[model samples]
Target: MNTTHPAKDLQVLAESLASVAKVTKNLDVLIFGAGLGGLAMLEVLSQSEHVSIHSIIDISEDAPAFQLAHELGVNTSTDSSAELESFRGDIIIDVTGDASLRSKLIAFKREHQVELISAKSAKLLFDMANQELRSERTIETQNSRLSLLDCMLEITLQLESRPPIHDITSRSFADIHSHVHAISGLALIFDKQSKAPQCVGAIGENAPDCSEIESCQSCNGIILDACSRLSQKERYKLFKPSIQIKCQAIENCYNVALPLWQDTRLSGVLLFDIQAPLSKEQKTTLKMASVHLNMTFKTLDHFQQLEEMAIFDALTGVFNRRKFDMQLHQEVSRIKRMKNGTLTCGFIDLDDFKQINDTYGHQTGDLVLKHIATSIESCIRDYDLCARYGGDEFVILLPSDDAMQGSCLERIGMRILEKVANFDLVNAPEIKTSVSIGLVTQSGETAHAETLLKKADEALYEAKKSGKGCLRIFADEQFHYTPSKE
Candidate 1:
């Protein structure tokens, strides 16, 4: 009393066949039985690149192998004699383990001149196919691992050059996309203080439009929500691994968010969308890559700290004397090449600084020095160099090709004096301080860094001698007093 619904069966058969046709093969096979052995054989043969399942037969229509063969798009039947009459395959694989069926197949094979593989031989062939499939998968996994390692090595080498963070993110995303076949990828660098994404790098045709601030705001919520799900322990780890999250923007896809860390802090996140679930090997590759990215960020940050320490004053946060010496020489060389360019050097000395330190203690004097450095920095252009030449002393270099070089120097000097006069001490508002600046300009003349500095120093001596709190310029083989507009 088992009636088959042919219409529904045909529909299911068509859909199953469509999905299976993704891989094609050549050797034609006809299988007997829908029992456990037959199901196992079908499973193994379906993955083989050289085998094409032609038909499968079993007495019971509801057997496992019968349903599986139907799903795989192979022809199936309950009546073995009827199917054999129409069989035009290369081989008959009898997995039913029935002696009577075997005898019948032997006679049919002799009469029709078709190959008959007995139940035992068929089982052996199935085992070999299964082994071959496993070997192929092993090789594929090894290849994928090697590719990921090579990519990490390339990125590590690039990091040594200390390229911009954007370059690192873009290249890393592209490589991951190519290797993992992700639908799209995005990398976000978070601000260490704000903990919000400060920069973004996106790739792929389906990437979200996050190039502008307004557009990026839409994704911020999603990324932060994903990050919040990680445990505190995971976030603090240097190689915080990637986690899977449901992709809200794209249906039928999921996102992998890899947390990039710099030591104990969360630095950034790399997210990519994948259409299918990743394999074990793919997941391993991603975890290893995330570790490499974390190391890269850490190395770059360390290098930046070292570089700043080497060139910047720890107290005032301005270029130190050593850096000033290096820049002065470079600027002198550049002026020499121009032949008609003007170079100006100004030497600054804080007047009555020692008395302030002796009266209020060195701590107060330190604050005063810091304030002076900030004041001078505010008055200079981006191209101008300001350095703490020594305690209570600063130097500035301005290179220009304009004819109003003297007037420009005067304006800068006036601005510095105005800024310094505005500084007020919290504890002692009555305490007053000022700077005496000596400036020297060189134009269309042979110049040296030391000679320019010496001339500026001489000009500074004149300013200080003129009762301090004033500016003097040495130019045209003479000393000119730059009257303060006060």
Candidate 2:
């Protein structure tokens, strides 16, 4: 004995009926039975885009297909002859297998000039339709898979260059929009500093600019709430499996949000609106695209971490000694090639940093180091380079032409001193912080990275000797001191 799968059989039957209806032009079908065969035909034909089911009839009003026809808004009756008299259909399918009903249908067909298919001939037509449906579905599936593969390949190639996150977001939105036919789309990433979701990319009219604003006034509160919920770890897990919510902004539209995860943490979100519901295959395709997006984010993050480790100081978040040396060499060569260019190097050391650590703790010492580095960086010009040479020591490189004077250097030193003097530990309020800076200016005649560093170091020694919180400049073979007062 062979057992049949009910769900699969129903799907196949539905596809076959749809295929038959599609091949005929605006075919109006009247099904004459409400038992198993009629019920199956009605179920599939009702959903066909090209076919309209006119009516279903049987002798018994309690037939299974009557309930379904009523639910589907199709006409139903227990009087076959009465229904046939009123029927204005192109074809009548008699699945009752009744000799008397067939004879009546034949007479009706002859008088009304409509085609009539008996139960045995109906089976043959259904078999042909089933074969056609299977062949069409095979071609469609192959084409869909090829299209999906092409999309994934393009995304992978674009990611290989490691473009900015915004570029990645826009490209991904366009790719997904092509397949999903969304009305509006938004890409958002969780900002670590703000601890909120920031919209990086948006498409469609009336889209809110949540990039810099604290809250989006134009966006629906429900949509914003959904975004906020997905940003949290616990809440993200609740909707992590699948999320589809009604869009309050657009009537009869639904919003779909896909979470982009970096390992266990939720990194970002992909959101879009759909006017119609998605099929199972379409949903699977979207899941695949989202997974690819997640992998792209993870890859970018790993590369950025590796780059930071290579060129930045771990403790202070400034350029490390090795990177500074490389920059020093490059700047020296660049200045040498120019006509009468000068490079100014400043050597900075935190005053009483060791005392701060000994008095408070190593953690406090680390904070002080970071604070000084930030202060120095904030005071310098955009083109200047700041680096951590060693513990409690930083170097700044400023390149200028011959007309550049010492007054500019004096102003930079004073700003750094002012910024550092304002530093006070939150818990250890009594702890004060200041920096001793030494500046040296080198002209085209004597512009060497090593020599410039040496002169800066000598000036730094003089500044320390004069007072811990002062600035000294070594220029023209003489030492000039600038006290930290004003």
TM-score of each: 0.81, 0.62
Residue 29 lDDT in candidate 2: 86
Pairs clashing within candidate 2: none
lDDT of 1 by residue, 361-398 (tens): 99999999999999999999889999999989999988
Total colliding residue pairs, candidate 2: 0
Name the runs in model 1 displaced over 4 angstroms. 1-27, 66-72, 82-90, 109-121, 191-199, 203-205, 212-216, 235-254, 263-265, 275-278, 337-340, 444-447, 483-486
Weakest ten-residue segment in model 1 by summed lDDT: 235-244
Q: Pick the candidate with the highest TM-score.
A: 1
Prediction-by-prediction clash tally: 0, 0
* Winning candidate number (lDDT): 1
Q: What would the per-residue lDDT of candidate 2 be over residues 269-310, giving only the tens digit for each residue? A: 777765546665567667777767777888888988887898
